[model samples]
Target: MQTDSKTIYTPFVRAKDSVWEVMSDVLLALIPCAVISYFAYGEAPLFVMFVAVISAMVGEFIFAGIFLKKWNTLLDGSAIVTAILLAFTLAPFTPWYVVAFGSAMAVIFGKILWGGLGRNMFNPALVGREFMTVFFPLVMTSRTIWYNKDYVNFQDLNIFNFLGNGGFTEYMNSIFFKPSGAIGEYSVLLLVLGGLYLLLRRRISWHIPFGLLVTFFILLQIFAFKDIKFSLGGILLGTLFMATDMPSSASTKMGKLYYGAMIGLVAMLCLLNDVKYEYMSYSILLVNGFVIPINWVFKPKVWGENINLKERVGAGVLLTIGIVATTYALVYLHHFDLVRYLIFAYILIVIGRFSFSKQLH
Candidate 1:
């Protein structure tokens, strides 16, 4: 009855050129954002790109071979995709050090530590984004990469000032690429073009990106339509191309839609609640974490196990107790922070609940 937890039997190996196809598509997908950032932000955007790609690939190779004891499939291109996507989410003009740090997070911490390549539970890009946000809150939240057109043509002065204490309003006219966050990410146009190229190439499914973009646009129109930086095109460019490409995310049609919709909805909520960081990279990662089980469960299953009446009633009662306790705590504490500790505990009960309703694999 017992089977190996780590065993992964696949009908198809990911294909030899599949890696290249995916990587190339991702690159093309990222192009629009890159170009947009370049036109708006300036030269610094490119540096972040370099840092992200180089560091992530290098990390992937090291972990895949020495750490994970695997062969040189660096050509597979997943690492490259992760790196580029990480770059796309960051502000274009961040300190090279910030990008360097994020690259390490995406590489060593994000993908490698989680078992490398396909086994990862969270989106590597969001790992990088979250790492930056948590450690360097001041730098990450300052909108440093957001370029202002007023400083356009005066590249040096504007770039430096933007580096220092530039105002988001001061550079409204410069548009997406002038010099905003995470190097190439500022240019919605460049990013969108890249996304289109990827779709054309069939590197990734349209479901995730399309779902994310469509949901986010609906949210953006109501919440951020008037905001200069958070317009329709820009939000679509970032979420559709950048966040949704995260490999660890859901792959099934229904799973992808729900996953992306959660991301879009949470991002809108984060914005509405005045939380910073565009597109909710961390939130995307969070949703991706929960989507793995969803995908597995959504797959057609062979029946084996059946629930007993006693177990069913017990589960229902415990779930009710858990829900009531959570509710009362939330209402009493006036905040959800009190329940953060309950999540892991709830994970087990939730798993038990789902397991009770399903047949064994």
Candidate 2:
């Protein structure tokens, strides 16, 4: 009966748990990643997480109390999850002010303005991260800011030194010990464990994660096979955590598959060319806007209910527009020749429309 995220039109079974309990499970899962981050990068990661969590809580308190007059909403723990997820995406040495600003934007604009929690259109944490990108591009995307004096000094203490030195060995060392990217993206092993925990807890479904990874992996093999290791950690992080967010993703079972696949496709397309910054977040936020149409297009039929042709066609049209827009945006972002993909996407849409019209009759 979770109407806010899942569709109310269908009777789907869900786990019966309070918001705080669910958020607590997510927090517990993230602990290992946080510990690994702290060990790999020193106190910088902790500082970012602390500032982000505090900023999110304070923002939730003020916004929920003043605007919604719902002071008790702060106890939900969704804000904490949003803050932590945002922190995971940032570099260890990201400025505290930037962290605070992103967290504030997440709670105030992304959550509270959308009526809090499940009512938001996009994932609140990703919204915050996107806001940071727009406002503090240098800090968010620059490799210079990713490493600090602590990290450089800590290199001498490499636990993987026992693996011995060489090209392949060093690569192995980086993957197992500390990969060079975001703070939480350091430990692929820990991230996988966290993802498995979420799966065990029923905090997430396999549909989104499986669909996303499989689609992305297959596409990477075909187009950009060499960059797989470089992108896998970040992709895993986004796939396991952000892309599976219930409120912002598709509601129906089949809808979830299509949603995940399209997210992977768009993300891979964006990454095809050389680019700075991760485009997975952009792909997620873009697909978040299409959830409504996806839900509508894939809604299950009720036994005794009458079919509404007008509504179905309307949803189809909206879905077509959404697909076209998403394709255009990805092409534009990478400065790819727009005509090629746009035309292909349009042709597919046309074929779908024709088939759909025939079925309706």
Candidate 3:
């Protein structure tokens, strides 16, 4: 008699939680914010959310099927999350076509084109928002929009007035009942509540958010001392929603703190330079591009591993070089218009090579 036995896979142990489970938890957390947005901004917010979410899902399906030849990833729910986030970053009166286009860019370039879910280097929603802000600034920062019209008088509302005086209550009421910003950004109370729920569920770590808030508060106090209220708004929205993104963020504990701090500092700089619209998203995207390098510098040590003096020195040298190169590149690009196209082309080639090289490995 012959027995038909199959070999078991290594350890055969499955995790209690899965990607879909975590995605579900994130979606649940956003429900309060979504409901709050509808009440605060009326039907427009809901309409944009619907259009964005559906477009993102459909874009992912079509792109994955045509390019990757594997279409089963739609069930992962990542596209939905990206859609919600992108919608949150949009102005309340954004057109349906713009929503659709942004969602497609997010799912395609930000996610699928980078080799799908886990391999994406930047947050998909942020990428979409940044793209829209660059190409369709008028649509994204429309002064004629209903929400913008309401907040028009408070355009220069500062932190001292918001917190020091009787402005706290007024600020709270504005954010809660009559928000005048992006759909999700209108309700700080709801977003905070959602973030707290995620914290309780251990769906997200606190280091990034905490660091971001602290750094942002301190920096605004020093730099734009008068605009603390404006700074606070950016801090809350970016920290709780954007900067806390897991995959696009650093993995190590120290790396998260550094990443958050970087975001805060960049945000302050943007404010100082008069970058008025979606500066938080821009700062977060700028930091996201450095996540890999940050991880490399802050990688966790192996158990029983020893650090050599030479290795430490080499790391310091590499870090210094990276900083200098980045600073020089920024300065050069800012001052020189003639070499901009050439530099852009070169950077694109380098990025393409790096991406393809990763695939080969």
Candidate 4:
């Protein structure tokens, strides 16, 4: 009976295959982006991609050899995924060394230093992007985002020369569909297909992705994302590339939902304020950094998990008590002005999901 039970549950935990599944899935998803990059920025995208991917793979192998004292994950394709992902986020004209530096930081500091693969606190791609932001701000921010600008950020290191000479609309269109950059990110259509594949493959859960999409689109439509006319694509991009991080995101369904909502909330605020810096990558990394602590403390009750009415009331009471305490403290600190939304979010989150239906047997 125990063995049977174990067999039944194993698929839920591990999926049908091993780590290579993820590596290949990510690579397959990246193909659209690569094709688009080739045409838009010409050969520069390919060249930069090659450098970035190779650097990331080599970095991973070296780090594993040094840190693990063995060859685990060296050829597992995770590094290739990381490399391609990092490169995908970059502009076509970025410098080769910049890619190498970012790749190294991603594999070594972001991943390997934390005992590798499943143990890191944030996404490796996010780490590389953030490292690029801090260490080489010019290149990351200077490269035009495939369109809307004619020139690279004067501060960039210029990894590829061809991106400097593309037509604006042509480049923009390439970003939308034509094979252009990295392996898979350039074409939005292909990204969606790949995302669907992962969903069906059960490689990731929908809770966080749905949470991210609904919250982001609603908030963006409500506040700042109005320019896009209620498009859920941005959040989709985040879900596929950023927030689905198995290690950093919440582990339980409820936990992942809450985590995704929090990220969406913070990112909406950022987008609303017109954060002139790198938008998607920066927001994703920030959320990734915050998820570690949130998950540690916010485990949710299991389905069929019992909740005593008395204990539930006690929790509500505790929350009320804490709010009251906070109100008093804020009063003393002259920060009471921030309490207006306190009641609103609490009421909605706690009260809105309730249906008042008959309890099912």
| TM-score to true structure, per model | 0.67, 0.80, 0.79, 0.69
RMSD for all candidates, in order, please. Answer: 9.5, 8.9, 7.7, 12.5
The residue-by-residue lDDT of candidate 3 on 283-335, one tens digit each, is: 78767778767766666655566656687568746764564355345435434
Residue-level lDDT tens digits of model 1 in 85-181 = 7777766567777877788777666666555666556667767766676567688767545554553433422333444455663443344344434
For model 4, the stretches where C-alpha displacement exceeds 4 angstroms are: 1-16, 143-185, 224-235, 296-361
Residue 57 error for model 4, in Å? Answer: 1.4
Rank by lDDT, highest first: 2, 3, 4, 1
| Model 1 CA lDDT for position 212 | 72
Q: What is the lDDT of candidate 3?
A: 0.70
Worst 10 residues of 2 by lDDT: 4-13
Q: Candidate 1 — number of clashing residue pairs?
A: 31
Q: Whose lDDT is greatest here? A: 2
lDDT of 2 at 229: 39
Candidate 2 ranges with C-alpha deviation above 4 Å: 1-15, 152-174, 224-229, 305-321, 330-361
Query: Number of clashes in every candidate structure?
Result: 31, 0, 2, 18
- Candidate 3 regions off by >4 Å? 1-15, 146-172, 224-231, 308-361
Better by TM-score, candidate 4 or 1 = 4
Q: After superposition, how far is residue 332 of candidate 3 from its true place, in Å?
A: 9.1
Output the number of the TM-score-best candidate: 2
TM-score-wise, the better of 1 and 2 is: 2
- Report the Cα lDDT for residue 111, model 2: 74
